[model samples]
Target chain A: MVVRRPGGRSARVRAAVHQAVTELVAERGYGKFTVADVAARAGVADTSVYRRWGDLEELTADVVITWLTRTSPVPDTGTLDGDLRTYAANVVREADGPAGPAVLRLVIALAAAGETGARAREQFLAERSRQLRTMLDRARARGEEAPEVADVVDQILAPVYVRSLFGMGPLTGELADDLVDRMLGTPGRGPS
Target chain B: MVVRRPGGRSARVRAAVHQAVTELVAERGYGKFTVADVAARAGVADTSVYRRWGDLEELTADVVITWLTRTSPVPDTGTLDGDLRTYAANVVREADGPAGPAVLRLVIALAAAGETGARAREQFLAERSRQLRTMLDRARARGEEAPEVADVVDQILAPVYVRSLFGMGPLTGELADDLVDRMLGTPGRGPS
Candidate 1:
């Protein structure tokens, strides 16, 4: 049995370890670094990392979850259109952020890495779908007809991600809004 | 100076080398293997691959171009809806194909690698955009109001790819038709 600290040294150490993992994944892709590398980069002892996360895969998954939760919290702007627009814009910002490409690559790599990676990918998708469902449920409660979770995924999220992953174009706010409009069947301002 | 042969031993050697590169990249992701590995897999001499393509980067780019051209030819079904439906379905099949995920990974990895990778990624996107433009142009000529190439990219291609990359769900034909319908503002059969 161990005494668990809620938001003290343990929280600081977890934060440091996650940042280290994110940077390493960004620079080296996946499967190229080790837990020891993460420990060293986080400026903590290897034993501490091992004691907490067990291995690199677990540590990497934790980092991805933390990043996703922190950066992409579900929006609640009162209306479905406003909620979707805010959600889409937030995604645009996150994908274009400094660590955006790295995190995207990490997620893609994890999806293809096998069972553990597949599990992480599933968790990420489930979390995203859950957030969208929350927004939709709220809109429905307000008597605003909501689109399926699949529509939000296909229309808004997919394009933003594809553009970012392939460097197709800048992820501007207008693009985000247009996607939301397209999904919601509101007349867009016409293509620029 | 080299003699040009359209479909002779030269073509055969090129095909073999491209196949080897595709398999290697699929199996090991990007930047993990070298020209010699490709040569060995293709049953060709290292000097032969070097003499023709110059380096691994050139060979990889050539493989991507070849794959994209061969797999994703633009369809001319006479109607914009038919054409989009066909195109979207083709993308689904490609993404679900044996080498689909590998090629997708290669393209993403290339985009993030460096200058050479960036150039390759640009070339790939340009080629894709050109194909879409041709289809859209034909639709306009046929008196149909075709959507912008960017619209198709954002609505159809992006979703298919994101679904494939993240394993979000099965990329069904219904999903493809629904996407085309959404883009065209057609009344969908309603969500299934």
Candidate 2:
């Protein structure tokens, strides 16, 4: 099972650590930020930080999980295209913001580390897959999606990921809508 | 502009370096493979390795590029679904191999490391985008795809990535065929 450590370090301490990690990530990027710096900024002992989270990569994963839970998987809106467009637009919008790019950098490095890093990445992906699976299950229950639509869902979601990881192109609002329309074969309609 | 120091080293030397890097990646993962290790394994001078490639990450990217070029793009069998299924199945087949998982681990890591590793990543993404765009263009020209089918391509491809990076599940052959059918919205098919 995947381990997710606690974030509440006595409210005040947790807030400080979070703020410190965020600022450092923004300033230096994930590659430059160290657990030592994070600890120093958080005013906690390095051991204390490690005690709560096993390592910097895992800790960063925890932070990413928290942020993703709050920000991503977008709203359902009862339409796949609309949901995807919202999801894609949301990524661009958020990524352009302060925390977004930094988070992206950190997670990539962690994931690449292999083993531990890969596990962290899986944790993040699980959240996304779970969200999609939930929506698919709901649609199945409601008879909104055909029995075979699960594969369609996989196809429909590929571009958002390709654009993000592979630097293919922008995930604009229009592109997102078009992707859903094309995949679902319901041109000009939102998910319903 | 992104720096791509191609063919700087002799073919034999480059091949040797890539081989060493591949072994190192498979055994220890990308994060653990340092320049010195690669240099020693390749029987090349450390300075030569550094002079040709700026860092371990850049070296990893170059090696990957070499690998991909050797693999070439999947051949067309006329139909879009056939092409995609071939492509997807190939990915699954390759990923199960030594170089496949090794390269995948590296790619996932690079994707996760957004800003801190910008230049190297930009080059990586550009390569991938170019390949996909070429395939999409061909698919469009062949009329195997509608005007909007490229979007479906992106969506269909995402799960392969999700599985690779997150370890959510295997990119099974069955899933690949199903994805192609659903995305194409062929006759006699439901959303399944």
Which candidate tops DockQ? 1
User: lDDT of model 1 at residue B20?
Assistant: 89
Reproduced native contacts, each prediction: 0.51, 0.37
Superposition TM-score, candidate 1 onto the true structure: 0.87
- Per-residue CA lDDT of model 2 for B1-192, tens digit only, reads 965467655766878888898888766644566899999999999998899898877887888777765663655777666676776676665654446645755665565556644666667656765776666678779865432334434545566654554454566777666555545554222232
lDDT of each: 0.81, 0.63
Residue A25, candidate 2: C-alpha displacement in angstroms? 7.4
Ten residues in sequence with the least summed lDDT for candidate 2 chain A: A183-192
Q: Model 1, range B1-192, lDDT digits (tens) per residue?
A: 887676788888888999888888877767789999999999999999999988887777778878877887799988987888888888888988777878888989888877867877877788778889999999999988877888888878888888888876687887777677666763321111
What TM-score should be assigned to candidate 2?
A: 0.65
